[model samples]
Target: MNGWSNHLIVAPILVPLVACAILLVIDERRRVAKAMVSLASTIVLTAIAIILFAIESGPSGFEGVYLVGNWAAPFGIVLVLDGLSAMMLLLTALLAVASLVFSFARWHAVGAHFHSMFQVLLMGVNGAFLTGDLFNLFVFFEVMLAASYGLLLHGSGQLRVKAGLHYIAVNLVAALLFLIGVSLIYGTAGTLNMADLAARIPEMEPDRRMLMEAGAGILGVVFLIKAGMWPLCFWLPTAYSAASAPVAGIFAIMSKLGIYVILRLTMLLFVEGPSAGFGAQVLFYGGMATLIFGIIGVLASQALGRVAGYSVLVSSGTLLMVIGINDGAVSSGALLYLVSSTLTISAFFLLIELVERGQDAGANVLAVTMEAYGDAADEEVPEEQGVTMPGTMAVLGICFAACGILLSGLPPLSGFIAKFAMLSAMMGTGAIGVPPTAAIWSLIVLVILSGIAALISMTRAGIRTFWSSIEGTVPRVLVIEILPVMFLLGLTLALTVQAGPAMQYMDATIRTLSKPSLYIDAVRTAAPTGGDVKSSSSEVESN
Candidate 1:
């Protein structure tokens, strides 16, 4: 494969956008057309990701950069393909396909627009991952947000509408702040390209540097808000709970976008000078707070949907904490955890929806009575009368167990691999700035406690849903319902079995991320004009 082939980078993004366009023109009622387009596009995207990964992992070990339109960096748009972007793209493709499969049976209950919006959202997400410019990142964020608006309110129920409105309002504010931050940086640095900005930022004046730091600080808050960080994430649970199962699963991917950008930019562009160490502090404290809030939310929530929502919050917190530590090894672990938790939580949400549907069906059927004379009847249906489909229960049980295991970080699972990686990295001295003393031990203790809390809460909920007897017999599970859980669980197991390659991939990704020069060289060398600029710490600090 040609290293400079921009199509490899662009295909994953364009395919989905093109599919969304084609889906819009087709008849809305044609389910076959929708499924064909979605599934085909997903497969193509996944294949493209795999190809890109293979090419990068070839004898050269890494493909540095693939410039877009043969234009040089600091002037023309660039698309840099390295470890981080590849890993993110692969994960997004995999999860998007899984979520789409999960939605197959519920398509009729939702609508054609549901699937259309989903493809659009995927396009935005992939584009965000591949783009090398900050402005393009914001554009993709808006695209995804727009699609989410429709998906969040696909059913148009009162609760969905209310939740959607809140979600929109909060994210719009975050978007506005994001733009402001971009403008501040552009005004100070005269460029929006991440590579160029990084190269030029180190030479900036002290005051200007402080201003850039302030701007970055504000921008970090916006990302934290998007990631559902503590104190600012109150809207996530309500909004996520109200969305349809597939929509919620898709939404799960959205939060990671903000975190990914934060990690990428902070480590690459922001960690060059005196202020390099400060952001980590923010991440650490924010993570701890977010973790506490999530646990409290889980303890307080009674509904299944809300509990899953809280789990997302906790996971996001944990990720931030790992990132804040600034250890590549730990970051790799967090990356793995992010992928595993995403799948498990999404499966759990789907299972909750199934349980809700079964209960609702039974309640509705029992609420009314048939009569020959057509007289009004006032017989009330017991809430516990819903039949538990054995197949559905079995699948839900498996999904719930997967969720519990992932949350608890048990052995032989992806979560375990991820946690073990972080622990190993932490145990090694000189890996992070934090001293290896009682304080570090305390931090580890807190993390363990959080994991235990999540495990206990999730286990209790699983027992109630899967093992406890209701008033009626178990309902039959639809094949469609079981498909998503099976697929996700299978993937999780595969990750466990093939931990070596995956870890190698993650380590390679971390190495690439840690070294921004590889990315810079690719863009600079690929530029048609051959004007290469070296990044300076002072310039980055000022910008």
Candidate 2:
């Protein structure tokens, strides 16, 4: 293998960092030039991610760590590349590409630091996915959140700003919780490297363990907020609805990042600890409530953006519940569901704008203005409709139908396969004598009811927007804008087509995740590759 192959893990983070820096020097008005740079960076990042995914998922692959600044694990920064991180990096790249492409339609130009902030957000997300320690996780989380604040208010509307302020305030509190939790853990356990902490936790003193538990509880609260668990997620729908289309599309992945951390850390740090998911019951019930609450919100949402935002809650809730199930078998399917649902909701966010364009913004003002100005001749021109059915309407309709299928977990798409896999995993093992577990039953019931709610909500929204709106003007959508939506949905279809291989990947991922020993050894004892500094594994013991 080539020497640089060893350094592949860092590329996802560094490539975007460099791109964002270069973009800072460019004039914002040079839209095409800036876009070309951003596009190129995304292409490169995606290529590297695909390569990493293939290598990590392939036979003979093993968990690998890249140490930063020659520092060893438990004491220094390291990036761990495993199935979970590899998949997340690829997912982030794909979303970045689609959102960046869609933004070229107008959102990118409307913002002052669109490209720079977008790339910085990618850097943060990739770093979060790859980091092997809690400290870097917090750092990257802040970076991602900071960039999102600007992106959320990109279009500078009053609603967006108001929601942005609320979003900022909420996250700052979450950040405080995160810091306190990490500090407590580090103070008690003497390390923050997840794998090392996993090793040390099983042997900690009781008083320190009690302290750690309190800290971990606070951390779980923070994650639930980030993951959009119910009640804590009251800020989500409004904030997301207020963002511009492309920005909101990328933000779909943000909540899932929180879910990923919870899943990853719970599997690693708490798998063998005495407490073993101390607050898991809360997560399970909270997730159920979140799913139910999201369904109700979806039903009540009058705007398409609000529905998309609430759908994020649905996806997060489902994953949280699945993770809380604490079964490695069910988790495999949950991972699949996570990928499909995130892609679907992102496509939904982008589709909402295109779908709403033709709807009356406020009283169909252009026609009224024309009539009021006594421009009777202008109104008499009978407003050209290109053909019997406009192409834009047809394209938007097709995309909307696909999003509905994916979101509702309907057939012939990955959503159905993912949900079905999860259901089978949950129910297949019900014993002959014992009543079904409450958690399992609740999961089953909520999953079904949520789907039904999504179906009804999408139907009503579709009918109002598509069927009854024949008199509404045809939306003018550019090919660039529409293509991103199609690409995202197409990826979901591809997931459906390759369900066999995808499931196998998830199976492997779950197996690795459930065993903290492998992760611990890889980080604390494994030899460093890439540009990482070499150090002794024994440092973990001393540290």
Considering every candidate listed, which one attains the maximal TM-score? 2
Query: What would the per-residue lDDT of candidate 2 be over residues 1-543, giving only the tens digit for each residue?
Result: 235676898899999999999999999889899999999999999999999998897333354678787577667798889898899899988998999999999888986989999999999999999998899999999999999989998889789999999999999999999999988988898788888788888788889999988888888888889899988999999999999988988898899998999898888877776868866788788999999999999887767888888899998899888887898778999999999998999889889888888887642344344446966454334455654667788788888888888888899899999999999888777744556688899899989888888898888777767754635788888999999999999999999999999999999889888878888877776544434535544654655
Model 1, residue 419: what's the lDDT? Answer: 81
Cα lDDT of candidate 1 equals 0.76
TM-score (all chains, Cα) for each model: 0.88, 0.93
CA lDDT of each prediction against the hidden true structure: 0.76, 0.86
State the lDDT of candidate 1 residue by residue for 1-543, as single tens digits: 353454688887789889988888988888877888888998988898887776676224347455566666655666777777777788788777777877787653465476678888988998888888888888888898899888988878899999999999998999899988988888777778887767666767888877777777877888898798888899999999999887887788778887898888887686665556658878877888888888888766657788889988888888888777777777777877888888778777777776655454343223222233333244454555775557656666667787778878887688888788877777776456555655346457666776787777776666545554333346556777677767877788898888888787777777777776666556555635354444433344554
Candidate 2 achieves a global lDDT of: 0.86
- Candidate 2 regions exceeding 4 Å error are 58-61, 362-388, 431-435, 528-543
Q: What are the candidates' C-alpha RMSDs? A: 6.3, 4.8
Candidate 1 local Cα displacement, residue 108, angstroms? 5.4
